[model samples]
Target: MTTSHVPAGAHPNDGHAGPRVGLFVTCLVDLFRPTVGFATVALLERAGCRVEVPRHQTCCGQPAYNSGDRKEAAAIARQVIAAFDGYDHVVVPSGSCAGMLRVHYPSLFEDDPDWGPRAQDLAGRTHELTSFLVDVTGVQAVNDQRHDATVTYHDACSGLRELRVKAQPRQLLASVAGLTLLELPDTETCCGFGGTFCVKYPEISDRMVTEKAEMVASTGADTLLAGDLGCLMNLSGKLHRLGKAVSARHVAEVLAGMTDVPPIGAADGGDRR
Candidate 1:
């Protein structure tokens, strides 16, 4: 497999008077889907945000938090908080990582008087990319881009349930020209890539993703889109194995009108811009 490809985003603070924002590029996105991160920056820039990629940033500590390792997670959380606390807002392309900052970080430092308030502050500003676009900036639509494909949008578990991110992405997708939006059956159903859950319970995860692949194929959509990279990878992986001719992409990539990168799970470097 090829390494993730990073796109060159416009420099933040490029003499623009937008809100100072930090882009929290998640681990999976950094290693496997860098286009999502770049697309996020593009969307933010278009939304009037001066986006910065904090060099000190690391994982959101979700792996440790979910594994019941609060000590390590908290330590990592402190580092993350320090890295992003200076920004006016912190945005993430992946909902799970956003949830880590928006929901879990506060809980991680609840008992500490020092880091507790800091965590709460960061949590309050952190938002999923689509949610930030719609709810915060009040931007109803993105710059209309031409993508003539019927696509199904998967509501990743965390973004849908945790961040309440159902309408924001759909609302933006509506603005894109020549894009037909098809609803995935049971769109809210988990893709069974619950971070480490798939690793621990491969059989059950496979079963769930198999059903998801079938539903995605059933939609007759040519493309599969989701806000979370992990879910995209899981569902895309299953669909690939089943020989489904669907292109999987992050919603940010489409919303940002980026056509230069391959789809998330393309086997032969397909979906080139």
Candidate 2:
């Protein structure tokens, strides 16, 4: 979507001396929702990070890795490792991608001698976006952004179970003015978008997401927010099919005040910008 990396001097490196963050804009965010990528950059810059979108960055090989294709996954992981080398931290907007980098990359190379050490080093620095802002940068609040909606948060499985991203996004959302967060029923349940899992078992996936969407609707919140785009897209599509009124968005959009674009799975399907 024509998004440029945050170069030096674009934002002052004040608080944390601008940790070099290599933004791993996931494939979904890059193709379906570019606003999330832009919002992530805004939030990182606000927290005093010198961000860069490495041109060589590609998919985290999550689909292949999950599909029992270790050979291809390892090849892609090697490329990702090389692309994000030299950065102080590699931050991803999606928890699933971040989890792959932080949790799975090392295991993929554990038996190897050369790439194994490199994978561990990179994994240590990998972090989800909200977690990086709150934990690594010590950012307590977001400034100048407000959402006056009755919002419900869905705990994406990867972010919640894998990365323990339970409270980081909520902690920041609490700082947002005019926002009311209503907890969703069974927030920890999967929305059924397990990377390639949905494609493999559409019937099972649809059933799970249908239940999740019903839970979201039961919350009676006007908006639904989640850390991972995959979950959001799955729920958003289900909600639309059910004719539910809730709008779905990446949490970074509201936190960074970049919600001028249409919500995910809108009737018009949103622009690529």
Candidate 3:
């Protein structure tokens, strides 16, 4: 619900030499973890981008789209497209939302001669954060950020398959000073938080997340990380219920050195940026 340019006063870099980025802060991050939004700005700033958060931005409408509500989804997509019309690039912290904006939005309006071109234009400019940093900005490393914990990573389905975000996060995490990256078995598998999928099929969703949580625990890593908050929150809850000690966080938090807050779903974690 915030149109603020940056979360918690995270400003762009001094020179503002890079592309002007309009951050598409997803609903999950805005509501559940504003720190992820803060970390996103910090990471983008560190990568030399001039970042802005447009106040008029709203949901990417994945839920409605996934539910086969094309009319409502297109209405939402047009709002997002209009809100972020002028940025050099649109960056999102969550791959799910980014995929919606980048991949699905065009198809949602493919038949509409008026909105189709706009959706396609917006789609071309949209990118997930890690991919934007590594692939677009040529940022190969994260400097001055160190997390001394052994961690495993999960590749959310949309980002991994739709956007091909496999090695982008790994490439950046490699630069963290004291961080050890443990590769999760089946890292590319879906975490079952498929927007509304989990809600519609709770039994199947629970089974998938339970297995995914077990895989995370098997790594024996102290922390779990991914680019999408929805997956992290789902797996975090499952891990907590299963009594696992692995903490879950967004990759941006570690990359931006913003892990002072407790892990997602930790009882002590409050809504503070």
Clashes of each: 0, 0, 1
| Per-residue lDDT over 142-181 for candidate 3, one digit per residue giving the tens place of the 0 to 100 score | 7666789899999999998899998999998998888998
State each model's C-alpha RMSD to the native: 5.4, 4.8, 4.8
Write candidate 1's Cα lDDT for 185-247 as tens digits: 788789899999999999999999999999999999999999999999999899889999888
Model 2: lowest-lDDT 10 consecutive positions: 1-10
Q: After superposition, how far is residue 269 of candidate 1 from its true place, in Å?
A: 5.0
Candidate 2 lDDT tens digits, 1-273: 111123322466655476789999988989989999999998888777888999987699988898899999999999999999999999999889999999999999999999999999999999999999888888777875678888999998888888999899999899888999999877778999887889899999999999999999998999999999999999999999999989999999998888778899875655311
Q: If the candidates were sorted by their lDDT against the true structure, best first, what order would they fall in?
A: 2, 3, 1
Show where candidate 3 strays beyond 4 Å.
1-16, 269-273
- Per-candidate TM equals 0.93, 0.93, 0.93
lDDT of each: 0.86, 0.88, 0.87
How good is model 2 by TM-score?
A: 0.93
Model 3 lDDT-worst window of ten: 1-10
Off by over 4 Å in 2: 1-10, 14-16, 268-273
